[model samples]
Structures are given as structure tokens and as C-alpha cells.
Target: MTLSKKARSISALEIGLPIFAGKRFLDKDLNRCFGDLEASGTLIEEIRAQELAPLLKGTDILIDLHSTIKPSVPFVCVPKFDHPAAEIIPFFNTQHIITGDGLLTQDGKPIYADTFVNAHGGFGITVESGYENNSMLVELIRDSVISALKHLGVLQGKLECGLSRAVIEKTPYPLEECTIWDAYWNVIAGENFSWTKPWGNFDSMPAGTHFATSDSTKLVAEENSIILFPKDGANIIPGSEVCIIAKKQE
Candidate 1:
């Protein structure tokens, strides 16, 4: 989600003119542009070392908000399975929780904002809260942030985590899925790419089924796996991710 929506909402609530304007926080895409602090001599570190590293480090707890490419239900993504922040996953509006396996990016760098925060000794959780223009998303985000603050004692209020609702712990990728993504993932031009099925987020694909294709190269599932973040093939970049193969977690 963009900060401009929240900024506008806050300003509108305070004043009646709706005169508040929202601006992009960073000029560049901070996720792909920033380098992992653990690695040495990467382009991200070379360029953003002095600028971006300080903003991520030394935070007590971090909650990052992201928008999904496809329309999706809200979900929580924990950087690692063992972090202290895992306990708060059930507090959000979603039932799904995805945990990372500490896998490095294809460039041998960590690409996630929550990963950088957690790596630097802070408890961090990433929340993928549907689409950016979702009508109810702004309210959901504000309430979730308030809930987190209360849970951490930063705000003095009643907790609003969806305690009465059940939560599902998503499993990490199976070995076969990881191997396929590492080896067969193609950075194709997404001018005409689209999923064969109208697959929702985290929907399972059977073995030997086509996922998506562009021109002559088609991506098919090698085994039973679920898909994550299947992007709508619109005016997207060539290197943008289409989707990830995963296993359904109980």
C-alpha cells in the first residue's frame, strides 16, 4: 500500500477540503534496488549503503505493508519461522501466514524489506494487504497498525488482532518447487502472459499443468504445488516476477 492513501485519509479527516496530496516516498523501487547488508560489493550496497541501510537498522519492531499484483485477500509474511514476530501473525485480518526459508535472491542478495529489518536484530513482519486501490484497505491498514502498536505496548488500547478467527500456517516451498524456480524460472516479456486458470492467491496446481507462458516458453508445474503472487500480465517490466511455486500448508 502507498503512504499517499493514508496521508490523504488523515488529512481529509482533519480538514474538510480533501486538499491533502500524497507523494511517492522514494524515487526508485526500494525493494529491488537496495542491496543486502550481509553481502559485500553488490550494486545495492555500492549505491545505497549510506542511504538505505540506516533506515532499516536498529528498529525495535517493524511492520511493512505491501500491495499484491493480483487481487488477493490480506496475509502476513514472516521473514523467518523462528522470529519473535511470528506470534503476531494471527492478529491481522487474514488467515494465511507465509514464512521464508532464508533463501537468498537469484542475485545472492536478500530482496525483502522485512528480511533486512529482521536480519538487523529487529522483529519484522510483512503484510500483503490486497490491492492498492481496495476500498476497505486503508481502514484495515490503520486498524492493523493500531492493533500491532497495542500488542507491543506502544499504544494504550484494546488489541484488535483477529483472535476469534482461525489462522493457517503456510508451508515453505518443497524441494522440487524450489529447484524448478531456481532453474526454470524465465524472465520473459510479459506483454501477453496470463495464467491458464483464474488462480487465486495460494491456489494449488496439479502436476504437469501449465502455469503461464510468453511466446514459445511455457511454465508448467512439475509436481503438486501452489502458486503465490501471480501477477496480472499488464504493462509490467520484463524482469518482474510472474508467480512462485509453493506447497499448501496445513
Candidate 2:
């Protein structure tokens, strides 16, 4: 299969740059990075139609690169049963599915392959490489890109094996049933709002234990389940509740 004419000449797509406004990088400076990297001058939508959409139209596979604040773990992103590419997605180490709804954005709409396919008419997958400054994670990112290319037959090589595969499945945890709570931004003296124990995505919080609180208000778990992405740090936003509580899938 032939890559879009532009993709053949242009190598990779790079987003989240221009550390400072009103500045441009020289070709040599950009060359310091791998592949044909270019600045996405505007929001992705602005250029998607004029540039990327065409390149992705006839394309069978796409690999989106992204980084997370917590770069210690690598994860693969797949749409919610909306695209054909999901069939070929390789399971990553992490079992969590980074749905568009879970992501932080000004637009409340979720970002999934369905949206991309509707606009570009192709299959694509997004991969979160890890934290921005971690050099070690960069190597992992490179390996993931290579593996994806090989899977698509864009590159030639013996594919590295995965430890195991984690299929994407969803078990809904209602807000009321999961003992929903909000993470406070500030703490005051004599206030009771505090996390008694650290919590994270897919972790279990015991029933009746103080999970979090707001201004002397106590929040306790009503049931035990996998904490699908906790509101730790700025990773989760205000008003968002625990979307899922992990129970044995029947």
C-alpha cells in the first residue's frame, strides 16, 4: 500500500510545541528530532482538513503520538468500537482505556476514531508516549512507533512480542453507586477534607473508608471497585465523578 504522497515525503506528525509564542525553529533545529516533524501552527482541526485529512483519507493505518504528565507507563488508545483499526490494535502494558470523554478539554465532546474517520475517512490510533521530559520514555515511544509501523507493514522488521494482551472492555460504575467525591484544590486548618490513602486508576477503595472530602464534608466509599482514573493532581478535573468501579465482569 502506498502512503499518501505527502506522508511519503513527510515522515511524522508532531504536536504540542512552540514552547514560546512568536518564535519559529530553523530546519536544522527541527532536524535534531526524528522523522519529518512539523509545527501544527493551529489547533488540529484547522489543518486537519487542508493537510492531514487528505494524507489520512486513503491511508489504512495511523499512529497518533502523545505524552502524559505521568510518563512512567505507556498506553495505547483505541476508539469505542467505531473503527476497523481496532481489530489490529496491540495491547499495551496498561489496561485502562483513555476514552475521549475522560480526557481534559474545553470542548465537552469526546475525541475518538469515529470523529477522525468521519472527517478523514480512515483508521487511526492514538498512543500516549509518557511524560514530556523523560528520555527513557522516549525510547519506549520509538519502540511503539516501530511496532505500529511493522504491524501496518510500513516498516520491515521482526515484531517484538508483548508480555500479554489486555482487551478493551467497559463496565459502567454509576456515580451514585461508586461513592462519588470531588478533590479539593486547597486545604485549610481545622478542615476535614483530606485523602486518607492514595488512590489511582483501577485501584480499589474499601467501603466506608474516607476517600476524599470537601470543607469538613466527609466522602466515603459505598462499595469496593477498581478506581478507574482517580482525581489525583490535575489529571482529573472538578465535577467529574468515578465513572467506573471494577467488579468481576460477568
Candidate 3:
């Protein structure tokens, strides 16, 4: 029922490849290594980005599907770099759509797969499908793909593609249509940080509410916002992103 288990239920890019078998990466977190052509190093991830960036550039409509560590309401991210994924945002079943005006970076450099693609000549999307235990994650992902393809005229008819017909028959494309602005979590002052509470995705808090603490100081929300991708307290590290502030897009 957790995201990790659901993530591994599917295969790698190639059929029957149990690529997600082990840790997320062999050397580094692959998601953070993208968007820098000048990024250099002997680290396997660094080298992989050097090779993969060029290949992902200029893709017309690319979807970087992901899941969150904490259980969440599925949503989509449209990075602030003039990304072109608006046409298909409403195609999926998710109601929450985030478009960040603030640029998210790691160590003063761009990070994230969709941002890399968006910076290039393409429509890039980062779709975070959260915890859903009732239905298979793979089938839900497939259904989204099929829906998007049909909306774009790429697929035709009620082609379930071997997914459960019962699930597909009740599929609803109607969305809550929340266009939200984004802010990264603010607990970056020190290491070994922990949240004030176990905050799940989309948990709302008022302005001035302190959500996290390291040492004796607690981090406060500057605006009334909802949380997204709240990392477990155990994973806290210096300069690491803890969560995101999803605010109403005005």
C-alpha cells in the first residue's frame, strides 16, 4: 500500500525488467541529477545525466510519473520554466494541479526530470500518483496514459489494455481543477530535522504554523498553504527538501 511497494509492482522501461528491484539508485538520487549539462563527476548518476539530458530534450509531451513517500492525493506539477503540459493536465483523474512560480533547485542548480525537459523545447509534466490500495497502481497509471492518449487523439475507444474492466468502466475524468502555486518545505536550517506532526500530502495549515523543527527552532509556514511530499522525519538532511507548500493559485 506504500508508494515504494506500488512503484516496484511495475517493470522498468523494458518489459519484464525488474529495474526497481533495489534502492532508488545505485549511487545517487537520479531525480536530482538532471537539468545541468555542465554537471560533471565520476558518480554514476552524474554521468548518467550527462548522457540522458540530451535524449530527453525537446520531447513534445513528456510525463515523469512518480509517487510520494507519504501517502498523498495524486497531483501534477507544471514547473515554472514556461512548461508546456497544460493541454493534458486535465486528462488524468487527479484534481490537484501545481504550477510553481518559484524555481526549485538543489545546491543552487536545477533539479528534477520535468524541469530539465521543460527548460528544453518540450511540454514536460511530473505526475505524482500517491497511495491507492484498492486498485493496482500499474492499472491506474495505465488508465491515465490511455486517457491522455485518447484526449490527444493518440488512442481510440475503451481500450482497457488488460486492466480491470470494472475499474475502467467507472473511471471518471472530471477533475476538482485546483490550480495551485507551489513552495518547497522550509526546514533547511539544519540536519536531523523532524516534523511537528506526521503531515500527509495536502494537509493544510494556517500562516505562521510551525511544521518542523531542528535543534530548538521550528520552521513556520509563511502563508496559509497545504503540504505535499512531506518527507519522513528519518530522512531529514541538511539542505534537503522536506515538503512543498501548495497555495491557491490566484
Candidate 4:
């Protein structure tokens, strides 16, 4: 997500208040998002070449952290199937879900890292820390970072229990190419999707069950598998439609 000056003000305030009050570590700005399109594009490429490339060369795991406007659920998104890191994280645990495909931006653009990694060669994943400026979400990110570092052998610690096994699928789902027209919602029924049941990619579904609808148009799941991350917030618009993510049977 693009961070504005106003947003960064809140971010700085949040980081400073905790540390000024006697937190153990001081939060440093890794990189700030510049609103300038040209500058930001240059920065992204330079960072990829000078920073990320060097660190990730020959590395097996990478974790990218991002904040979202969605509620509390954390999402671990993998663009490719069968990645070592993707094969380790759980599909559902503590409100976190491991997903492969979904609309990454409000503009209906596919995530860049997926394509970048395929071309450059590395395993990368995006970890969505839910709801902007939330302390609990921030803590969840910190914990996940610590756990990931330990898993990578960068940190030594006792492993916690109930570490769920990763649910891997044979075939990866394709990301949908779509455009957003306008925002719409069902008046009688709230939100057009469900996540109450834990479904894996390629998991089965009844043929006639309504998966989602826009305007008067309805969509259904062709086969059973876990549904990937659902569109959250006011991100989905009227003409926006996401390609269904399906996993092959285990």
C-alpha cells in the first residue's frame, strides 16, 4: 500500500510513543514511500537490484510485510505453487490464511513480486498485516517475523506448539485480469463471500452453491478446494471480478 505523508505521520507517532515510554528497541524507517511515480519506480528497481537481490540471492525463504485495510485476518500469499516457504505455513490458524491468488490492488493489478521472482529466480511471499495502524496487527507481524527468522536459522529459539502443517496443492491458480467499474453490495445480505469454513485450494463444493454475485450476476465454484483470500474493505468495485483460485487434489 502507498503511504502518504499524513499516513506516515501516524506511523511515526505510533512507533515513537511506544519506544519513548521505554520499549526495548527503536523502530527505524527502512524505506519511505514517495508519492512521485518516477521516483518511486526508480527506488523500487534500485532496491530490488541493490538490496533485495543481494540478500535473497541463493536464499530459500523471504518474507515481505505489508499493511492492509481489511479487518483482523492475516494473509500469507504465495504467487507460485510448491514453494518451500508456502509448503510450511498453515492454511488457517489464529485467523491467518495461506492463499495463492487474489486481487492485490484496488486498481485490479496483479502483484509484481510473483512475476519478478519468476523472471529473476527466488522464492518470495507477501504477509498482509491486517488493518492499518493497529497495534495488535503490528504485534502479530513482529511475532511472525521472529518465527520466520527462527525457521530460517537466523534466530535460535524453542518452537511453539500447534504449528500447523502447510496444505500444498498440485496446481497453482491463475490470477485474474480485471478492471474495476464501481462499488456495489447486496442490500439484504451482507458481503458476497464466506470464510467461516476452512477450505483448501482445490477443495470441493456443491455445484449450485452461490459463491458470489455482482449486480444480478452470480458466480459459483466449479470444484471444491479452499477459496483464496476474499476481497476486503471497499476495494472491490462493480465491474471488478476476481479469477477463482483452485488447487489440485492432494
Candidate 5:
């Protein structure tokens, strides 16, 4: 099933409260407007850095649970160093572990929760519990947390094991950098911008094939490339990612 349908299935979080409340959780970056702080630029960042950063600064271990857009097997991301985060990988049901030298993209963007928390002297790992809105997503989070708590000695119980003792190393899929040329809000009806084919994470397409287009302008594949994060709809904004053309890691 698609991620949107799965997310919509959870009526409590997706529809129920937001019906009367108006604003939804994903409507804005709540971190930026945490309180009545009407500041801008450096001052706003500085306030959050000093005040909010301290709350997680002293935390011994932090697990940031998140969801993805694709149907993914739950996985954990740990820093490459011989840290405590890597030691607890076998306790849960997840069979994938991504260990990075530094949790930053080639463009220097921090891609994992461990990136922020590790800077503040806390052992942190990011656990992606499959697609956001999946029925099993919460169960994955609960299982991971419970297993971790037991492992950390915070809770006493026989750990309920789910998966076997092997984990897929690093990332199952590698992403390549795709430059954003432009974003087109308008496209030809029933023939607007979209992937040339039905795609999964890391599904490859060959060169000279058109991946997406708005009007007559097409983003042709530059190489034998993989499609990443194919959007469900054609609502495009300026600077939004159209596609990341990548090849399999040889």
C-alpha cells in the first residue's frame, strides 16, 4: 500500500484532532516557533540552541524514531566509531544497520538524529520504523524502545527477539546527488511530471530515458540511474527535488 493511504489509516493522528484543531503537526516546523518567540535569523537559532539544546545535552542515550516515505524495513543508524549505539543493534527486530563515518550528507547536511545529539555528549541513534502512517510503525517503535530499555538496564525483562542475528550492513540503497534544475507547479493534465516508470527505492533507469517533465521540458536520465523518493502527486514547488539519478554501488 502507498504511504499516504497508510498514514490516512491512522485516524487519530491524521484526521480526528486536526478536524477541530485546524493546524496539523506537519503544517510547519514546530521547532522554529516553539513559543511566543517572534525573533528571526541568528537570534531565533541562538535561542533554540542555548535553551532547547540543553534539554537533550545531558541525555545519556537518545533514540530518535522517524518514518520514511517508502515501504522500508525498519533500520537503525549508528555512527561508525566504536560507540555505545552500535552495541545494541542485535536486541530488536530490525535487520538493517547503517553505520556512517559522520552522519552528514556530501552537501554537509546532517541526515540523522545522531548528528545533533552526539555533538552534545549523548549516545544517539536514529531508528526509522518503516513508512510514516503504517500500522506496524508504532509497534516497531515500541519494540525498539522496549528492547533498548532492557539492554540499558532501565527495565528488567527477558528481551522479546524478533529478527534473526544478522543485519544488512550500512544502507541497502545508496543515493546519488541530483541537482534541482527547476520546479514546475503547472503540468499537462494526466501527463504531468512523474517518474517514467513505477519505482521503488534504488530502482534503476537507463540514460536517455525521460524521468519527469513539466510541459515539454523533460529531465532526462544522465546515466544508468536509480530513482529515489518518487512523489505520489505532481504538486511541485521551486527548488524541490525532482529526482536523484543514481547508479548501484559497484
Candidate 6:
């Protein structure tokens, strides 16, 4: 009796949208189309991650919802640190968390959609939920979809939200796991890239700070960093990942 059911809210911009790019996806990045599902690789997010990877194979859990290309704050991502969605993410109220992240591609495996629902064993859960004109990014994405449906018990009782209880009386902010070490790729950004400042995701950044340059080369932040997923001028894709610099996992 592994309870709690009913999921499905998907919106890769309402089905892999890319009508002239604002940077998110067109033929890719439907969270990296589950390893490019090749039904002739018929784009449109590789046939929507090949019909949503057979409806997440035998699903058990999968939260995934994101929004950040600049502004930041809310966070959550899991692909490791013993992911069972990292044991229900401390019941999420978001204070930031990303753990054991690896393959941002050295020739594959960024297969996100919560990494293909954690490669079928389920328990995925992404949730960046910030940025996109943050005005409390819509009540913190409706309180991270009601705390990932009340700690995955699949929500219940008295609802009718619109936020107000100061998001369940604030407090959050102490999760911090972070992790990844350094990322900045856009593989020589085709002879140009930019961003010397105007950071975002977790921000901090200290040791050497310089931040970005690319083809002219110069990316700094050698240590004492935090930034995550920056994507400066967006036309990216030269091996992708334009920013990542986590730290605090200790």
C-alpha cells in the first residue's frame, strides 16, 4: 500500500514550446529530453521525452518544476546524496538544496526531468521555483506545490490557498546542501560570452569573483562561491552549462 497518488501538472511551456526561443527549449531542454528519446528523435522534445518515458516507468515520486535563469532563492534539486528525493527534502519549505550533482555533460547524461525520474527508480523532485519576475514567485510556486504535496503523503484537508500565513510562518532557510564545485561551460562560447556581474542563484561568490568572459576566457570565482545556473546572454549551447558553482555541502 504505497499510498499517495494523482500527479501530472507538466508544462515544458505547455508541451515543449520554443516559438523562437526565450531560452528554455525548442529541440531540446525539455529538461534535456530524457536522453534524447529517439523515435527518430522527432523533436518537440524528442516526442515529449518519448511520451514521458513510458509515464515514468512505475512511478513512485516526481516533483520537478523549475524557473530560474537569473533571479533566484527557492531551490531544490536531487540526483544524489542518496536520493530518495533526498528523503523527502526535509519536507521542503525551500532554503536551497542541490546535492551530489555530476554529469552536466562531458558527453551526455544531463538527462534531467529529474534525470529521467532518477532513471526509473523514481523519487525525482526538482523544484527551482524562483525567477520569472519574482514577486514571491507566485506564492513561492504555491508553496512549492503545497510542500510537494505535504511531504508526499499527497496533500489533504482544508486548503483554498492564496498564501498569507507568511508561508506557514516563515522559518525555512537552513537547508543549504549546495555541492557541485565549478561549472561555467559554454565551451568557448563561440568566441564570445559575457556577464561580469548581475548574478543570481544563491549569489555569494567571493574568491577572485571575476565571473565571466568566455571565448576571451576569464571566468574566476575560484573558491568561496555559490552561484548556480546563470546563463548570461542566452544563445548558449556549445556543450551547454553556462554556470554552476556550488559550495557548502559540509
Estimate TM-scores for all models.
Answer: 0.63, 0.46, 0.75, 0.41, 0.51, 0.31
Cα lDDT for residue 166, candidate 4: 27
Whole-model lDDT values for every prediction: 0.54, 0.42, 0.62, 0.39, 0.47, 0.60
Q: If ranked by lDDT, best first, what sequence of candidates would result?
A: 3, 6, 1, 5, 2, 4
> 85-201 in candidate 1: lDDT tens per residue?
455555565656665442235454545556676777766677888866685675666666666555544556354485443323223323232221222232334556656767667
Q: Kindly list the per-residue Cα lDDT of model 2 for residues 15-130, writing each as its tens digit.
A: 32455242222222111121112444343333333354444455555666655433235555454436644543453333344443333222332233323543355665666665
Worst ten in a row by lDDT for model 4: 178-187
- Which pairs of residues collide in model 1? none
Q: What residue runs in model 2 are displaced by over 4 Å at the alpha carbon? A: 1-11, 20-61, 91-108, 112-121, 130-134, 156-198, 206-224, 228-250
* Per-residue lDDT of 249 in model 3: 66
- Higher-lDDT candidate of 3 and 6: 3
Instruction: Using TM-score, rank the candidates from best to worst.
Output: 3, 1, 5, 2, 4, 6
Q: Report how far residue 233 has shifted in candidate 3, in Å.
A: 5.1
Per residue, candidate 6 scores C-alpha lDDT tens digits across 60-79 of 66666777766677777766
Ten contiguous residues with the weakest lDDT in model 5: 178-187
Best-matching candidate per TM-score: 3
- Candidate 2, residue 171: lDDT: 30
lDDT of model 6, residue 197? 68
- The segments of candidate 4 whose C-alpha lies over 4 angstroms from its true place after superposition are 1-61, 81-115, 131-134, 153-207, 214-216, 224-229, 232-234, 237-250
